[model samples]
Target: MKHLAALNKYFWKYRFRLLAGLVFVVLSNYFSVLAPLITKYVVNKLMLLLSPGTTHAFHESVQDPLARVLINRIDRWNFSNVVALCGVTLLVLALLRGLFMFFMRQTIIVMSRHIEFDQKNEVYQHYQRLDTTFYRSHSTGDLMNRITEDVSRVRMFTGPAIMYLVNLLALIGLSVYYMLKDNVALTLYTLAPLPLLAVTIYFVNQLIHKKSERIQALLSDLTTNAQQSYSGIRVIKSFVQEKAMLAFFRNSSEEYKTNALGLAKVEAIYFPAMSFVVGISTLLTILIGGFMYIRDPQSMTFGTLTEFVLFINMLMFPVSAIGSVASMTQRAAASQKRLNEFLRLQPEIRDKPKATPKVIAGDLHFDHVSFTYSHTGIKALTDFDLHIRKGQKVAIIGRTGSGKTTVAQLLLRMFDPDQGAVKVDGTDIRDITLKSLREQISYVPQDVFLFSDTVRGNILFGNPVATMDQVRQAAKQAVVDGEIAGFAEGYDTMIGERGVTLSGGQKQRVSIARALIKDPRVIVMDDCLSAVDARTEREIIGQLYEYLQDKTAIIITHRIFSLFQFDQVVVLDDGHIIERGTHDSLLEAGGYYADLYARQRERDERPSEEEVTQEK
Candidate 1:
């Protein structure tokens, strides 16, 4: 009940709708319960009227105290007319019940959907606010299940479970009042099985909640298995590991199935436990009421007994629904706990209360900065210091683990440094609002990520309000306009997920266009030209130097010759600056940079066997 109480605010959000739906439920129940009372009156009339010349004493005490008034009218009318009148009244009540029931579903269940929509939006919005470190520590599949499946379970609790539970309480209260008024002893007998039924439901729900939470957790694992397999399908096929991956998926699926069945087993036991109690109460009513009726009709009359059975039949619907409500209640509790936990998480990298907003000039500095990844606890950069003047173009060249990308990450404030500060334009980056800092810089990483949308949409993703002319200019600068024009729908064509439909070079160029459209104060290109041909790379570089004039730029590259045009090149090895200079100066020094340049130039000059054979 406490778990359910947490959803009251969502219900209150649509207070008018919730009130209207419950009012309809009440009206529907009024009509439904009215039918049985009419049956009780008509039956007693038939028994007495058919047995003509019965004692006036017996006729005086009909089931209803107000029956004497209706009987005086009935005496003038024949039995056939009286029975037909009751039939018409019952038919009208049934129709009214059905009409209100429809409106009840429309109001309450539909409001639940509105709440669900709001809940999912809040979860997604929070995910956006969390820093990159949160995502690196979490799995994509697990996050998806939390927002989708868990929210759905909470919705069920808000809507259908609430409706049923309310109806159950109301029906039982109303039935108890009438039962006690008619026969206290019989009502006491009927309620005897209730406590046991309640006890059974309590223990059963405990089992249900425990198993459902486990099942939901296992479902997340299964989702992760499927997501990883599909994302790495190409690699699996290339390495001939299909069978191994398939076995892994099979094992995950079996675990999910086994846990699901375990929940189903407890659910299976719950229903019969409720039904067995219902059956015992029904058997007792018939047996006890029959003996009392035979002993004296006044004490427990035939019409009275029939009416009592009808009320019990009416009570059976909500009572029988207890099994389903219990199951749903347990599942909802687990899901609500899971969703609330996620919502309560505070992002570690959020801006301070008084963080300032400022336009950046992009004069960046790393002042003896040091950082280590949270998971590995090993320093990525230690006592590292560098400074770039505003509007300067600097290149960082490093091997795979030598921390080239870490520089871009720190500048973006994806994670705060452990020891020292990162500054932009004389102010520590921690003082700047995250939105203001990120908006001033454009980053194009080595591995491109494009949404499943049109090429034009992907390019304009950074600056959604950019015009067609601006879009075309950016595309041309990145050298992807010609390829886009050849597509059947041009800019409107749907590129598949992560730009899988495009070639690697085309994907990289589109990512470059995405960054170019931002028109930011600073730009970071992290090996973004690795997929493009050497000629295209050189052309892009020539165009960038002109188009991105006066903007601070960091170009991380492996092409040693490409470093010649840069204002400065800093070579890194094992998180230390190993070499620094222009191509001419480094060559004269005959250091690591010179050796790398000579080796790459020789490799390029050497022809392949196919070219050598053709020459011969």
Candidate 2:
């Protein structure tokens, strides 16, 4: 309930609709209560007409002049006429009740749907704003469940649960007021079972809250298992572990089933319990009203007893709904609590209040920067320092886990350093807006990611305003224009998820084209060419050299591109810089860079086994 308070603003947003719905609830209940009173009037009139001898006495017993006139007119009417009148009146009341009920649902339920839409958008937008660290700590399944399933539960509370709750209160207040007006003692007895019913509901709801929380948690786990299994289906098939995966999923499903059944068993008690309470109220109304009538016929009439019984029966549906409303409320509370957990989380990285957008010239510098992953507690960079002037091309070559990617990440401001600052154009990056910083720098990661879209669309993502000619030109520079042209639809061909429809080298080249399309001041290619063969790689380097001459480029890779002359070459090892000089100077020094270049050149010079077999 406390967590559900987060939706207060949405409720306030739709306050007018909710207020209209409330008025309809009251109007609907008013008509509903009128039917029982009309039935009482009809029954009393029928009795007077049937007993002709007592007709005069009934008229004499009526003290009010208004009632006397009404009774006399009803007495003159025929039996069939009286029956028809009562039927018509009840029908009209039912029609009115149904109309208002429709309006009630229209306002309340529709508002709930609007709130659901807004809440989902809020969660998704927050997810987008969150830092990478948050994503690393959370699973995709759980995130999906919160926005979808949890929001749906909250919607039930906002719409149906609230509507029914209002309906129950309106019906009870009207029915009880009329019952007491007719006879106090009988009304008290008729309502005696209600207090016990309330107590029962209270205890039952506590159990329901606990069980509902467990069920929601289990459902999230189940959804996560299914999502993970689907995403990793290829891996499972490759490993021949389908059976093992199925067994794991089956275990989770069985546990969820057991808990769900337990909750159902608990919920199953509510209806019977409610029915039994209602039955007791009905029995009390009959017995007590009969005794009071027998003791004094004038004090309690037959019509009065029928009316009291009708009131009790009218309360049955609302009383029965109490358990269900409570169940929904509990479930909604549990879900709202889960939703609040993520909604309240502030992203680790955000622009300062006074930060302003600025155009960048790509004079990048890492001054005594050090960073360790909080999740893994592994120091990736230690006092790492570098300086790249504008329009300079630098290559950082290192083995795996040598902090090569960390430089790109820091430059992009994905994670701020713990010690030193990253600067662009003599300004600390933290002072610049994230959108501005990222827009000027294009990054092509080692692991390329592509949307399930046309090849043209994926390339245009880097610059939505770029022309088709620019897209083709960028692809040509990346050496993927020929491969794309060979496709049946050329640039319009739809790629599978993560570009599964394309080969590994094709995906990397497509990513390179995406980066190139941006025409950014700074382009960081982090081992993006690893998937392509040496020949293709050299061809791409040849094309990129001219295109990147005016742009600042930082190429991070393990392999050295001997053909591409870089202004500066850096050798990194174990989070420290081992060498920094021109490629020729590093080669002359005969250090780690020299050794690595030697090995790669030797491997390239060696002939393939297939070529030797062809020679034989």
Candidate 3:
């Protein structure tokens, strides 16, 4: 029930529909309780004809003075006609039950759908609000599981759990009222065995809750493992580790199965025991009532016994439903706790309370900024002080793990620096609204991620309202226009998931085009051109040189062909800025920058074996 506290907003929103559904449930229960009443009259009337003295005994049993008048409606009519009349009345009540059930299901079930729609989007939007730090610690598959399976579990509570719980209470209330009216002694006798059912259910409910939590946790791990394996299938294949990966999957899957089987075993023990307890109630009712009937029809007549037995049978569902209802409640509560923990996370990198929507002027500065990744506990950048005036171009060159990308990340405010401040136009980035700050910057990362959409759509994702001309122009600048044109549907052609259908170089080109379309005030390209060959890289950089003159740009790459185009070059080593100068000045220093430039030049100038053979 505490888990449901999070869903109060949704419940309040659909309160009217839920209220109407409950009204229908009340009407349905009213109609449902009428069947036993109808059967009671039919039995009493038949008994009156079969055994004439039984009716006078029945009159003595009830304190009602008009018991004969109420019980003997067919005194002037024959048995068959009266039986037909009772049958018709029963049929009409059954029809009304069906009608009310339809309305109840329509309002409640459909309201569940509406709640699902809103809750799913709310979770998705919360994900969007979360910063890169949250994602760094959270797995993709776990988030996916929370959004999909977790939402479905909560939705079950909204639909079947809610509908049945209320209806069960109403049915039990009405049935008890009618049963007590007929014979209070039998009603008390029927309830004597119910405490045993409640005791059994209480222990089973605890087991169900614990087992369900374990099963759901195992499922999250399994989903995360499976998703990572699929995403990294190419790595596994290249290393010929298919069997190894499959074995790992098998182990995780087997563990999940084992946990699930344990829960199933608990349910197996529970449902049968619950049914047996309900059966005890029925057996006790029949045995004692039969004895009473044999002794005297006045105390418990055949009609009253028949009606009482019918109501005892009705108790079967509420008793049996304890297991299913408990199972759903436990699963949903476990999922809710997981989802709430994630949703409750406030982003470390977000707009401050008094943050202003300041338009960036592109004067960037990292004032002795230092940062350490939380998971690794290793400093990615240390005392990194750098500045770039508006419309200046800067190139960052560093060895692997030298923190070239961390600089770009800081500029984008993906992860705030642990010490010192990153300022834009003389104001701390934290002082500016994240939307306005990020909106002014266009970043193209080393690993490109494209949506499963047409080439044009992917390009336009940077600016959804971009014109087709702008799209084609950005493609041309990235030197991918010819490839797009060659596609059968050109810009309309659908790309596979994450652009997996495209070659690596092609994907990089499309990513570049996307960033280009944004036309941001500040642009960051973090080793984005490594996939393209020397010739295409040169062409793309050449085309970008003119357009980027009026915008601040940061290029992070190992390649040095376009190094001279930048106004400044900064060299990083072990999270420290070891060298800083223009390309010529850095080469003159004859340090890390010069050594790296020489290595790149050698690789680019080296020819393939075919060219060497031709010379021979």
Candidate 4:
């Protein structure tokens, strides 16, 4: 019921259709009750037809002599007429039942589809707004399960659960009404076990709900395992750990199986116990009616007894349906909990009241900024101060964990800083809308990632409306134009999932081209040239300087050779700035940069000089 309560808004929107379906159900139930009366007439008529002189015996079973006379006068002794009446009743009941079932299904399906559509979209949109902090803590497969499998469970609850429960209630009400009309004493006797049946359902659902939640959680774990294995298939093969991966998957699957079996066991016990109650009610009805018939034949008519049995028979399906719907409702309740947990989360980054969309000129300044992750409590950046005037090329160098990428992320507004401010064109980035800030900056990460799409599409991703000439020009600037032309279809060649079809260097170049096409005011290249050879890095940098003469650029790298071309260099250590100067000035100071440069120059000369002297 709680799960159903969450879905009430969607249910209300189409309540009219539900009402129409219910009206059909009421009509269908009434016709079904009439069906047993027609059946009773057919049975009694058949008995009378075979034994023509037994009309007096049939009448003697009635309580009142006037009622017996009335029945006797109405009992036409014709086989065809009785058969025709039974056939017409069966046809009418079948038609009404079929029509009601169709409408019920239609309404339920429409409701579930609309609900699922809205729910999925809402979840996806929420996921989009959530910061990297959430993603780093959760797996892709877990999110996928929340969006797909969990939502499907909600659909099952709304669709089949609604259909069955509504029809079951109608069936029970009609059956009870007809049973009482036939014989009040027998009807009361038949209902003796109903309260126990209800109690069984309630507890069984409690157990089912607990186990179902566990099973769904285990299923998410299994999905996570499978997704990780597939995404890291190359790593698995390289490490020769296929057996280990298989063992992990097998364990996850076994856990899921055990939980599912536990759920199945609950169902197995609930239904049999529920059915026993139904059987007991049926047996009691028969015993009571038979005794009443034998001791006081005038108390009941054969037709009335037959109709009572038929009505009880109709009650069986709805009663059994209650057990089944109970199981579905429990599963839906568990799924609802998962969906609500995800939906209730607010994004770590929120827009300000004065946030407005404004185009960026990419003049960035970091003013005594500091940040720490919420969980780790370790500062990624501490009182970091730097500035990049418009159209300046600034290279950042640092050891691992020196907060190199944090600068780029802050510029993109991935997460707001805990202290100080990051501004672009004299406007605090936090005050600008996230979309507008991102539109003016392009980031190419060290570990390049590309979508499963054509090369042209990947290149134009940053500027989807860019012309083909613009895409080609950006590709050429990244020095990948010749390589793209070598492909069978050139820029039309499709990169496989996550760009697996391309080599490491090729992927980096493609991503670079993607950023280049954006023609962004600020371009952030985070160690993007690491994979390429030194000579190629120089060539790319040459082309980059020429192409980006009027744009601000942030280059993060470790190569001392690559450090010489920047308009200014900023060196970081332990999340603190250690050096900020031109290349020659830092070298003359004979500090950290001087030591790194002299070591690199010695390594390059020693190998080359020996090779040359041997050749001479």
Candidate 5:
């Protein structure tokens, strides 16, 4: 019932189809009730005519127009005409019942399929609107199952389970009403075990519900493990850890097997118990009705006894079907709970209300900005303030986790500062739409991720509408155009997942070209040149520097040569700026930068001499 109200919005749109299906179920149940009554009429009416002394009396008693015409056709007719009329009525009702049933099945199928499509699309669109930080804390497999398997469960429950329950209730209501009308005393005796059967089914359903939850959880875990193993298969193969990976998978499979067997054990017991209840109901019907008929054969007619027996048989399927639907509904409810939990979580970051997109002029500022990922007050950056004007290149140097990447993330609005302001073009970034702010700058991350696509497709990712000539120009600036052209298909060659067909350096170059294609006012390169050789790195940077001289650029790198080309450099140690000046001025100040430059120069002069090294 938690998400029931929310789900009903979708239900209302398809209410017409659902109403039509329900009408068919009612009509079908009505026809089924008619079968018992028709049988009773034939038995009682035929007995009177065939009693050996009432042939003329039976023919005179038929005063109805349809009956008189049939009776007039025969001389000394007994019960054959009456039997033939009942058969024709039954055949007509059967045909009409089949027509309604066909409509019911088709409408339910169409309604459920459309609902599934809408739910899946809604989930995907909602996921895109969520903040990137949400993805950082969740796995790919978990989200995949929510969209694939969880939506599937909702679809199945809505279609077959809902229809079956409606039909079962209709059948039970009509059957009981007719049974009581035939003979109240006989109905009481036959239904005496109904309460006991209901109680037993209730307990069995509760057991299955708990076991089914466990099985769903186990299935999710197994899916996560399999997805992770497949994504990291290259690492396993390279390290020759195939046997170890297999052992882990075998253990996960065993856990899945255990939970599945637990569910099976409950179902195995429940089905047979249902059958046993139906058997007992049958036994009671025959015993009580048979005794009453023998004691006073004239008091109880043959037609009434036949109707009672037919109604008892109808109860078998409804009771069993109700239990099956209950089990499926519980599983669907569990899946719905998980999916709603994800959809309700508010993203940690959002644009301000009434915020507008602002055009930036390439001037950036951080004023007394302090930040911590933890609301518990562990600071990642403290009182951080810096200014970079247009047409200036600034390089930041720091050890890993010394808050270097945090600077880039904060600038991109990945998270907001705990206290203080980050302004671009003299306007606070928090006051502008994120789309407008991010559009002015391009970021090349430390780790390059390429899709399974063509070389040209990857390069022009930032600008999909770019022409082929522009794509080639961007690739040429990245210094990998020649290498790509040598391939069998040149720019048309397909790259495997994450560019498995390319080397680390090649992938990094492709990432750089993607950023370059955007042609933004500012560029932030976070160790973007780490994988390439020195000569190629220099050539790429030389071409990039000429084109980027008039744009604001921030370069973070471990290479002293990469930093020397920048106009100004800032040295950060322990989340505090230790030195900030031009490349020559920093060396003249004889601070951290001076010492780092001296050590690097010595390394170039002599490889055998060992000295202090910074780990990043």
Candidate 6:
């Protein structure tokens, strides 16, 4: 219940619609209570005509002058006409009640939908603003469930649960007022079961809240398992572990089912218990009213007793709905708590209050920078120092785990250094806005990720405002324009999820094209061309060199490309710079760089089995 306080803003936001819905609830209940009153009037009038002796007594008993006059007019009317008028009146009341009920749903339920939309967008925007560390710690499926399933539960509280609660209050208030006005003792007796009903609901709701939290957690796990299975289906199939994965999925599903059934069992008892209590109230009304009437013949009439019975029955739905409303409220509270867990979290990285955007000129420096991954406790960079002047082509060459990629990550400000500062254009990267810093640096990571969109759309993702001509030119620079043009729909062809529709080399080329389309002052390619053959790699590098001559380029890769001479080459090993010089000078010095370049060149020169077979 406390967790649900977060939604107060949304409630206030849609206050007008809620206010109108409240009015409708009252109007609907008002007309609904009238049915019982009308029935009482018809019964009493019919009784008077049937027994002529009671007509004079009924007129004497009526205290109100207006009611007396109305009764006299009704008594003089024809018997059939009187029945027809009551029937018509009940029909009209039913219509009016239904119309207001419809309007109640229109206003309240629609407002819930609007709130749902706003909440989802709010969560998604927060997700985007959070730093990389947050994403690394959270699973995609769990994040998705919070926004989708959890938000939906909250919507039930905002819409149906709230509406029903208001309806229940209105119906009970009106019904009790009318019942008590007729007879106090009988009304008190009729409501005797309600306190006990409330106590039962309170205990049951506690159990339900506990169960709902567990169920939501299990559902998130189940969804995560399914999502992971779908995303990694290719790996499962390739490894021939289909049965193993299926068995794991079945186990998760079974656990979820068992817990859900446990919750269902609890909820199953709740409704029947509610109905039983309401039933007791109805039975008490009849028995108590009968005794009261027996004490004195004129004390309570059959028409009044029938009216009391109808009022209890009118309250039956709302009262019985207590179980459902309580359950929904508990579930919503549980879900809102889950939402608040993420919503209340402040992102690890955010623009400082006074931080202003600055234009980056690509004069990069890593001054005694050191960083260790908090999750893994692995130091990726150790007092790493480097400097690159504006418009310089610097290639950082290293083997795997040599921290080559860390350089690119630092330059892009994905994570702040623990010990030192990264600067762009002689300004500490932290001094400028994160958006401004990231926008100027185009980083094509080793693991290329592409959205499920058209080839042109994926390319345009780097720069949404890039012209089609610019897109084609960027693709050409990456040497992927020819491959894209070969597709059936050319640029419009949908590249499946993560560019699965394309081959490894083709995907890498497209990723490079995406980076190129940014046209940033600093471009970092972290082994983005590892998939392409040497010939295509050379062509891409040649075209990129021409296109990026004015912009700073930092190429992080294990392989040494001898096609073009770079301005500087830094060799890294075990989070330290082992060698640093131009490619020719490093090869002349015969250090780690020289050895790596030699081995790579040897592998490249080695002939394939196909070539030997062709010679034979």
Best by lDDT: 2
Q: What is the C-alpha RMSD of each candidate to the true structure, in Å?
A: 2.4, 2.5, 2.3, 3.7, 5.0, 1.7
Query: Which ten residues in a row are the worst by lDDT in model 3?
Result: 59-68
User: Residue by residue across 1-616, what tens digits does model 4's lDDT show?
Assistant: 7655778877787788767767766766766766776666666666666767764455333343433444465566467764775586579778987786777677666777888898889889999988889998998889999999999998888878887888788888877865675578878988989999988888888899899899989989999999999999999999999999999999999999988998998899887887788888878878888788778645665666777777777787788888888888889889988988888898878788899998888789999899887867878999999988998988888888889998888888888899999999999988899888888899998889899999999998989999999999998999889899999999999989999999888899989999999988899999987788666777788889887889999988776754336788888887899998988888898888888888878875665665789999
Compose the digit string of candidate 6's lDDT tens values, residues 143-174: 88999999999999999999999999999998
Candidate 2, lDDT over the whole model: 0.90
- Model 3: runs farther than 4 Å from truth? 55-76, 562-564
**What C-alpha lDDT, on a 0 to 100 scale, does residue 553 get in candidate 3?**
94
What would the C-alpha RMSD of candidate 3 be, to one decimal place? 2.3
Clashing pairs in 3: none
Query: Residue 407 in candidate 4 has what lDDT?
Result: 89
TM-score of each: 0.95, 0.95, 0.96, 0.92, 0.88, 0.97
In lDDT terms, how accurate is model 1? 0.84
Question: For candidate 4, what is the lDDT?
Answer: 0.83
lDDT of 3 by residue, 1-616 (tens): 6877898899899999999999999888888887776677678778888887654544334333333353356445777887787688778888999999999999999999999999899899999999887888888878898989988988888888888888888888988887888789989998898788778878888888788778777788889998998888889999999999889989999998998999999999988988898788889889999999999766788888888888878768876887777778878888888888888988888889999998888899999999999978989999999999999999988889999999999988999999999999999999999999888899999889999899999999999999999999999999999999999999999998889889999999999999999999999998988888777887888888977989999999866754347888988988999999888888888998888888877876799788899999
Best by TM-score: 6
Alpha-carbon runs more than 4 Å astray in model 2 = 53-76
**Candidate 4, backbone clash total:** 0
lDDT of each: 0.84, 0.90, 0.86, 0.83, 0.79, 0.88
| Candidate 4 positional error at 522, Å | 1.3
Better of 3 and 4 by lDDT: 3
Evaluation by lDDT, superior candidate among 3 and 5? 3
1-616 in candidate 5: lDDT tens per residue?
Answer: 4543456867898999888889988988777777766676666666665564533232343223443454455424456765776688778778877887788888876788888898899899889878867887777777888898888888877788888888888988888877776567888888888798788777887787677667767777778888988989989999999999889888988988988888778777777777787778778878888888778655556667877778778768877776677777767776777778878887777788977899777888878888887634557788888898977888988777677777888888888988888888888899999899888889998888999999998988878888999888898999889999999999999999889999999999999999998999988888888899767887988888887878998887766664337877888776677789888888889988888888877866653323334321
